[model samples]
Target: MIILYHPRATRPRSRRLPLAVLALAAALEGKEQYEIVDGNLEDDPTARILELIARHKIELLGVSAMPGPQMVAAMETSREIRRLHPHVPICWGGYFPSIYPDAALNARYVDFVVRGQGEDTLLELLDALRGNRSLDSVKGLSYKDMFGLRHDNGERPMKGPDEFPWSPFHRLPVEKYLGPSFFGKRTAVHHASIGCPFNCSFCGVHAAYGNKEKMESPERTVAILTHLVECYGADSVQFYDMNFFLREDHARELCDRMAHLNLRWWCEARVDIMSRYSDETFAAIKRAGCAMIFFGAESGSDWVLEEMQKGITTQQTLEIARRTRQFGIIPEFSFVIGNPNDPDRDTRETLRFIRKIKRINPDSEIIIQHYTPTPQPHDAGGEMYGKIEVPFPDSPAGWAAKEWMNFTLRIDTNAPWLKRRTKKLIDNFEIVVGSRWPTVQDIRAPRWSRIFLQVLSAWRYALHFYNFPFELHLANQFISLRKPKRESL
Candidate 1:
């Protein structure tokens, strides 16, 4: 038996499909007995995973991870696994591994790495383990021979979306991954496309998947979506496309197919796509079950956008937001505030633009994150990485360590008044990073007012609950009521 995993984050509470690992499992289905462990959703995940490995007599473990905090957690899990069982092979795949394969393979905790797409490479690695097959046969793989010189088979072919089979949905922990959805319990994440052609300076995608874009046939997309709705009773979907509208005609055709699925879905796209597509197409998108769309309108300052090589102007972004709202689709944006040129000025401009957006469209949602200046080697040019005196992290371990060290610029606002306030009010208290600003709901408030707030919350929940079809809504409640008793009794 084999075990594939999505390692836990620093402290993960939300789960999603470990798509890469599950894809491998799908390919090896009839050949092996395998189970996927999602550390994010499972309790005491590392311990549970260790227990499962021992019980199943598992020989190899695979983990797929992105960079940043998730990579840190993955290393923590793998280090623990290696400490207890040194002989078991632990393979690394996904974002950090693909871009920094040599560094990943050199790490004490990682025995092997599968770069690019892992489906075929991983299966071949398993074949090598089963019989004494030479590792040299596998493409897009990196590892050290007994002599300890690393070999990376640099020539790997790219495969299209149609080449891989559908996701093994039965292995997913669906209900446990419940995200914020207005109309459903089971949230299905589907993708109609893979890869993006954009060269935004800060993005690592161009390195991971390369610049060529591919779209799954609209028929393939509809079939996958239908399985989610018919098999799991999913009322909502989150499309995992990097740029959902890379090709305007295909996007419209995709939306046309989506209209009959009876699913409420959301997707991410660039602002340039909004201007590129006609208003009627957006109306078609909204009618075809897309209630919300997220745009990467990173900064309100044109200079920062230009610095980031984002390619779109502030006027273009604002106009895109206006058009999105005009079509009755909720417009959401992802923003980054701190950059070198004028950190405080940039943040203020962002807040001003968000305030303006809210004034025009009160329900629009925006998330603003403080920028950390650590550069990615893949996206780093001499103009950016070389010009800065701060050294780039040479290894994944160094990158993880640098996150806590003073190498990157954090808290860039050096204003005296703000510093005093940060020390006195914010820093003195543990304000969680990226948490929503709190509103007043004091326990000391008068009893009647507290009661009113409780009633208001109930009213809001009721509104969300009533959004679904009556029969489907009743079925969900019935299932929920039965689920607890079956377990408790």
Candidate 2:
């Protein structure tokens, strides 16, 4: 039996760890002969799919898709697959199908949708298919019955992140990927932990991984990092965990192990974790090769934080920013504007928060974001669900680079001025960044072209976050980021 997975690629030139594909690959290890195919690594993914179909006698095909435009792309692929090989069953999984199982089933080409964590769900599904048994017993499996009735078997228990065999990264097209990360060294994305401790309503982290985190052992984490370094020539790691510092001891242990490897790394933490760290702990984080840390300071206003149930305050965010900068780590904070409670005022507060962070860090990076609602309203009754000009893109790169990415203006807001400026910047971004979607080549564009793009990005942020003139906001930004107070420790 052969199984195939095509995770929509984010960039034509870059591919990070596709954990869903990897996890499924790990499960299939030694059980069957299977090939893992990446869509992002191809010039024409459909043609590649056709080539694979012609070559392999596949028993099962699993295609992962996210919500928005990616679903369309998956639908197209499924259509093509059904046309070529009518007997092969296609199963769809990931964030899109997890919540909208019934809706996803509307696409006649999709044979099944695997909701939530897929390792166990998929394994059970493959077992059922082999025996040709009724799928009614499979948990987290959603599909339409032969009579066209919808059947959703509900969520399967998630296997711990560490349970998946060190993710057959060997099967991935790693050599084709370069550093599109913080350190700008050959980078690999890894998750030492799964799940988030907090539930910020707008976030889907809770939807993907429940509130309680399931983490790998410190020793396992080190081994994985070492494997990536030795095997993949990766010098940097992006933890990509929802919240890595939830346990200070766990973090410190990982840091000590990381220090010996001398590899630069990045991770996300909550502002509340700042209270858990002393000056020495922060210093240790730096010494351990943690070059960057991100905090989702969701909103700027105290009321907004209360509304989002973010559970962290403006004060905590400020304290963390100060400590991170003082300890010689690059602190990146993200804020959400346009929460239901006072969208205009929320944006203003977010702006203030960003400015305050700049004042604290001066030489760090920060993101001020407008809240983007999912294509389908997550809330049935909330403020008539703010609309967007276009549904989110379906491709992996779309997920990586657009509005939610802190780059383009994809979502519309109540604030008139914010909407206007956002539209302008987004239009300009399309012009400068996309000869077709921007590539790493765009990053290396001529100085004037890069400056022009920044000029556009700068004005958009200024218009939304700082009430001051765009020129003044740009000036303040330059002054704040101009000089490093100390040499890299």
Candidate 3:
């Protein structure tokens, strides 16, 4: 028996489908006896995993992990499993291991790190364990040999979604994952594409899946979503595609079919690419229930954009803001503050630009993140890699440390280049803007509290005084405003 574990990454209310583990399970379907145990649903995931191992003759334990809180939970659970069941092999796959394979392998509990895409790699690894193939033959694998020497078996070429079997939704408690969101009452999530074509410096998509993206056919995509709608009563969907909008024809065709499903959806797209989309396509998208588009408007300065190797220009971001408003779809602009060269100027310019965006489109949502560097090839991250002063931790335990956890979440990154004053300014501004325009995604905040926050923060916003919004901060303690970046799974 094989066990696939999805460590708790978000709150139960914020949990979506564990697509990563589901993808791995899809490969093992019919051929292997396996079960998926989601940590989000369990109060004591480690005990549950140990119970399963004790009950069944488990061959391997596969874990899907991400950065931040998930890594911490995964480490603790894996450590306990190793101590209790010394014979059971533990393997980790996902962004955490893909980005830092060596660090993942550094943990004595983790016997293997399936880097990059894991569907094929995992199956091969299982075969090797059964003596059907040599361990060295498994591409996209990092593992310690019998002599305790680590070896990386290089990268595997990414495959189209069509190449793999559909996710075994029947194996999951589908209703538990269907939750309320800004889109609809019962919202579902789907990843219709594999990887992203663009190679943004700050993003880990390129490192995980390379710059090549293969999308499922619109027919197959619509079919799967139709199943979710008809069988599971999913009224809305949010595509987890790294880059959802690629080709105009693909968008138009997908939208054409999606119009019949009646799903109010949200997705991430490139500002430059969407800028070139036709007005007819935009109308089709809106008609098909495209409520919001999350664009990576990383910085306001053109030089910073070039430095990050972001192909979109500041002008394109502004133009898209205007265009998205015309279509009545909200454009959620996310900015990465604190550039390596000059953080203060970057923060100031980006804040000013965010204000401009709000002025142009009152419904536009702004998400602010500190610039935290990830492990990437120098060329992929541009010259910014050389500018980072702090070295990344060499082990999973070190990464699970409090400061590094904050760094992973990009919440309170104490990077060498960032000043405390600058971080304070960003926080104060975030509070003011978030209060001034309470997020529509926030279903938890009471209507009265939203009105109260807006009324309280109006003067500060109008006066352009973002410093020390103590009242708003204090109000938030009671309101507990939901940040979509953190809440949205």
Candidate 4:
């Protein structure tokens, strides 16, 4: 049995941990030999997949889809597999499918979809398939019958984080999949837990994992870290948790354990959580080789923050940024633009907030992203649900394609404006700094090339500041923009 993990794009690095976790579980169960075939790792995996299916007489294929363009690719892959190997069972599992099982099951090509945590459920399904047993008894699965009727087994209780196997990083081509930025260094990605306690309107956290946050036991987290550093020789570990600091003591214990090992790591945490952590805890995290932290400061406007249910004020965000910088941890912040309720004034305010953050930490990086209305299960009850236009398709794969295309087109259309505004804003900042610092030309680009220079500078900054490959794709769209030519149908 082969488990093919299809990435959302041509780059397979970001989804490494998820794929590793799934593969590791399959290996541990001793059910069947599992291998990860990343679609994005090489040229399209279509031909290779056909070869593998025929050579191995593969019986089961699993595709992971996130909410965007990748889902479309997954759908296309499933359809292709069904066409070539009708006897094989193809499954879809990931953030989008887990939240919207109906949308996934409704797709003609998808035989099954798994919601929430998939490790145990997936293993069970694979075992049943090997024995040719009925799938109705499988927990945490949604499947369709020959009559085209969908049957949902309903979600099982959330799995404890400790129950999950350590990621099977060793199974993948580690060096080949590492991001360009970390090419020279050995990096491992892991998650300390699943779910978020907050109920952000535009976020799918609560929908994917219930409102309750789960923390991996300190021992389990330490064991993974130990394996990465001692076994894999990982120099840096990145935590992909929704909120790394939700359980303060758990975070502190993890930090304390990490401090015993010489490993550099990074994690995402909420501004409010950072502000509330004791000085000793912050010190412990820094001592634990935490080189950087990314905060989801979605907006600088209190109104926008409230609208998003971010549960953090603008002042709180600023304070956290200052304090984080004081602790000598790289404070990477992100903000959302084109907010649904944002007028011209609100947009300007967000840009001004970026300037403020730069002033506070001259070396800090601010990632500016356009707001996207992603629908969640709970979105139906949100105030913005009906008002905000979500462009996602009904099927997981279709939605993925729409998201990728939308993001591509949006960046292409907004490139000139982004370039112009970024230059204007930077020049204005230089003027403010020039009053106090005589060597301020060092801060500003020449007026003639400021726009292009700013665009380049923003791209360079975004490589490390944002999800590199995703931003690279968005940048490519901006660089490729040309007036469209009319075509006849």
Clashing pairs in 4: 68-400, 69-400, 69-401, 71-397, 72-397
Best by lDDT: 3
lDDT of 3 by residue, 1-489 (tens): 999999999888878899999999999999899999998888888888888997999999999989888888999999999998989999999998888887889899999999888999988998999999999999999899878898888789999999999999999889999999888989999999887778677887887877888999999999999999999999999999978989889999999998999999999999999999999999999999999999999999998998888888999999999999999999899988889789899999999999999989999998888887776622322234446546778789999988888888877888778899998998899889999998988876779999999999999999999887889989989898888767642
* Clashes found in each candidate (C-alpha, N, C closer than 3 A): 0, 4, 0, 5
**Model 4, span 243-284: residue lDDT tens:** 888867888888888787777777789988888888899899
Clashing pairs for predicted structure model 1, backbone only: none
Give the TM-score (vs. native) of candidate 1.
0.77
lDDT of 2: 0.65
- Candidate 1, position 100, lDDT: 64
Per-candidate Cα lDDT values, in order, are 0.65, 0.65, 0.89, 0.64
Query: Which scores greater on TM-score, model 2 or model 3?
Result: 3
Better of 3 and 4 by TM-score: 3
* Stretches of model 2 off by over 4 angstroms after superposition: 178-180, 374-489
TM-score of model 2 vs. true structure: 0.80
Alpha-carbon deviation at 221 in model 2, angstroms:
0.8
By TM-score rank, best first, the candidates go 3, 2, 4, 1
What TM-score does candidate 4 get on C-alpha atoms?
Answer: 0.78
Q: Estimate each model's TM-score.
A: 0.77, 0.80, 0.97, 0.78
